[model samples]
Target: MGMQPMEWTENALIKRSTDFGKLCALHERDPEAASAKLETMMQTVRTMLEHVGVADVNNVEQASIITEILTKKFRAMHDREPETTEETNLIRSFAQIHARVQQAHAALQRQNGDKDTSNKSPNAPHDNAVPPAA
Candidate 1:
């Protein structure tokens, strides 16, 4: 079977988080160039979402909040901001939520695997019966 809904959500979240980290790394390596690239990519993502007809204002709001928090953290880390206590705390909160979501996804995957294995026929081919790699 394909990935469950929760698995897909977790994987997407992880990928996005990694993408953000890569963006931050690029910024560290070259701030001016990275900022321009980040801005372009952000606009691209927004346009793509709009094209897909997912006109959810909540999603847009969430994206804006996340972007603000990310920008503040980046500025603070680079000493562009003298202090960023609130932004730092927001980042920490986001990290905690990310971890919890990941953990829940893992648990769901494990539960699904166990259920499938228990339902498998003994005569089924072992390789064919195994869950596909994530």
Candidate 2:
């Protein structure tokens, strides 16, 4: 028999609330604090997956991943009297990832002339975001 696949990512993120949707909601409610934490966790996952030669975040998935939690973090950065450089950079990286993913999808569509490439997109830079201590 083949080895069983390990699926620890979702479990690694387990919180008081085990529901993914509810956990996301809780994070969104405090993006200023939670976004950085979430981003760090996610980037680590991405790195580990890439190391194992299985990192594939397509355009649709990228779009879905940038949920209210991320946008609220972006907004929080902008709401400051003077947005910190670090905050601006983090939000801007998200925007750039979104744009590049969209562009890759469009290019792939044109190249294949209606043939689906599974809507795959270019990988975004795997830089980490560090939130300043409160």
Candidate 3:
């Protein structure tokens, strides 16, 4: 058999989820702060893209392109082998921010989904709901 995947402790996962929730709360309370953080990240990515050029860059095409680039750069810089304390902390912070932003986005998506679901007609049939098929 192949090796089993490593398991995370329940407490660890709960702590992480809680931290992500807190980040979501922060985003909700002051979206400007999140926007500033993202803008800073985008500025960093733009600087890197200028350095490397768009042709040389592999992954900078998505909405979260800046976050993706920063995460990649951060990992490449620090996660070679054993990590120093500073490197570990940097990675942790980077990961937390990323996770928090993603969680906030997920929360937004869920809210949007709920709104859409609530707005839909309960009696509508799937195929005949809208105008005739073209």
| Alpha carbon lDDT of each predicted model | 0.48, 0.45, 0.44
Clashing pairs in 2: none
| TM-score of every model versus the real structure | 0.34, 0.39, 0.36
Q: List the residue pairs that clash in candidate 3.
A: none
Over 4 Å off in model 3, which ranges? 1-63, 114-134
lDDT of 1 at 132: 53
Clashes in each model (backbone N, CA, C under 3 Å)?
0, 0, 0
Model 3 lDDT, residue 78, Cα: 41
lDDT of 2: 0.45
Query: Which scores better on lDDT, 2 or 3?
Result: 2
**How do the residues 54-87 of candidate 1 rate in per-residue lDDT, one tens digit apiece?**
2333443344444445545555556653345644
Model 1: lDDT equals: 0.48
lDDT of 2 by residue, 1-134 (tens): 35444334433334311333343555558865666665664464344333323133342343334432454544654465425665566556656654544444444444455465565334522132223369
Top-down TM-score ranking: 2, 3, 1
Q: How big is the positional error of residue 58 in model 1, measured in Å on the Cα after superposition?
A: 9.6
